[model samples]
Target: MTEMRYTTLGRTGLDVSRLCLGCMNFGSEQPWMMNDRDASVDLVHEALDAGINFLDTANVYSTGESEEIVGEAVASANRDDLVLATKVYGDMREAPNGGGLSRKHIIDQCEASLDRLGVDYVDLYQLHRWDENTPIEETLAALSYLVESGRVRYIGASTMSAYRLTKALYTSDVEDCSRFVCIQPEYSAVARHEEENMLHVAEGEGLGVIPWSPLAGGFLTGKYEREADPADGTRGAASESVRSYFTDENWAVLDAIRTVADEEDATPAQVALAWLLHQETVTAPIIGPKTSEQLDDDLGALDVSLTEEQVLRIAAPKQPRYPES
Candidate 1:
């Protein structure tokens, strides 16, 4: 096994593993989900044993089943040593106040998530996405209460525009609310849009960057071939999100990653992950592996060091831009 490395989450004193185990696949929400309780729990244990101490889940993932699985998986482990993170902002019920960053919903969902997680407090609580319906002030104030009440240690945000993020940070400072210590964006070799603004803002604000879908929804794994349909039972065949990556432009990027992987003697997935690890602004990349073998393969990226040239080569095909021409 590759020796794991740790780093502080952004400017905070909280230390987390360089890779966060994203628990999105541990439930029966979709056809592509793991859907097996024992297997999901075992995978979490395997990741923990492999030195991934940071676990990221959300209230909406599998309708909170992911949290239950993660909670049950870690019930025996020392909680202090693990960074348990989760997010809010997705509807849990069909009722009016079921979700969003509203103070009422945030407070309610935090409690619900804690209950499902079988914990008193989450190490890091985050907003799953920007809630345009709720004022940023209201959201930050509610999150501040979570911190003051000892139900949450730190707060973060995910998948928001750079302008909104900057405003939220400014609001937190002026309003004396708990500030965001990190930001989660959909960043990968195949999806460089965040680099045009989101990443720069995160680095400037000293926020930890934990990118979701770092493999471009499995496109960067080099499992799918050009001019061919995805195999049965594969993510590409089952998920429109995965099939969306089948563009000539993205294929060009994958070609570069394959070339680098051969040179480094690493798998295409490892090469893709290593590119994120090579970035100075990235604190961790969330790895969502459905199987133990996949988890082990992702961990190997820690040992695959790419030269500056290799990193640039893999990134060169798809530079950050808005609305590709």
Candidate 2:
């Protein structure tokens, strides 16, 4: 971790870790049970010790058990030094008013999230995903109100269309509301769809970009090679969200990435994340470390760098066959 680095979060003037630890796996140990309190605390402490100032979690992760774990971790960490973040706009429950970007649901979820996180405020409060039914103004105004109340320090949006993101920014400017200053997108060596125009919009607008699934949900870790059937219990094999990165084009990209990893004397995971950090517009690569060993390897990306040619060789952008159209 000698060469660990960070990047500024858009116009917020916050310096966040180049790699933000994503906590969606929290309390998801199996059999529909959340992680025990002690193990959760330990993971948070370990990440902080490794200089990971950024942590990303959401209300829907583990059906809110993830938020409880995140809350416990933050209390255990005990600091305003950490750049903690969490998201909303998910189906918090089965109730009609339980979800959406409307003021009622947004505020309700923010309070619930604050309670779950056990914090006075979160560094960055993000909309987990877009909601088209609600007007963008309603969402922005609600977030602005949160800022005014000091419950949320800043605001961000996740996995939104370029059109919506632009509209939100303009609406904020005109209405004097809290604007989204960052974007969270599913980006990886094999999934680079965000690069098409969403990322370009973020850069042009000076909005920070954090890429989720930086390893293509562990497909870039080299643990799921062509010859090796994915580990039986691994998330990728089990997850409906990430099965496609395993396709043929991604396999070619994987081979190219592995070659670079060997040349740099770095782990494939590390090389993959470094490639993400190399992108001019990417502020942070969201990494999910299910265990201490995995966390350590992911953090090692802090010291890895890819040569320009090495970067180009693996950046087969055309691979995300189902483009973000």
Name the top lDDT candidate. 1
Kindly list the per-residue Cα lDDT of model 2 for residues 225-323, writing each as its tens digit. Answer: 777766666766677665767678888888998999999999999999999888888899988886788888988887887789899899753444336
How many clashes in each structure?
A: 0, 2
- Looking at model 2, the pairs that clash are 27-34, 27-35
The models' CA-based lDDT, in order, is 0.93, 0.83
Relative to the unseen true structure, what is the C-alpha lDDT of residue 262 in candidate 1, on a scale of 0 to 100?
93
Q: What is the per-residue lDDT of model 1 for residues 18-120, given as tens digits with 9 covering 90 to 100?
A: 9999999999988889989999999999998988899999999999999999999999999989999999999999999998889999999999999999999
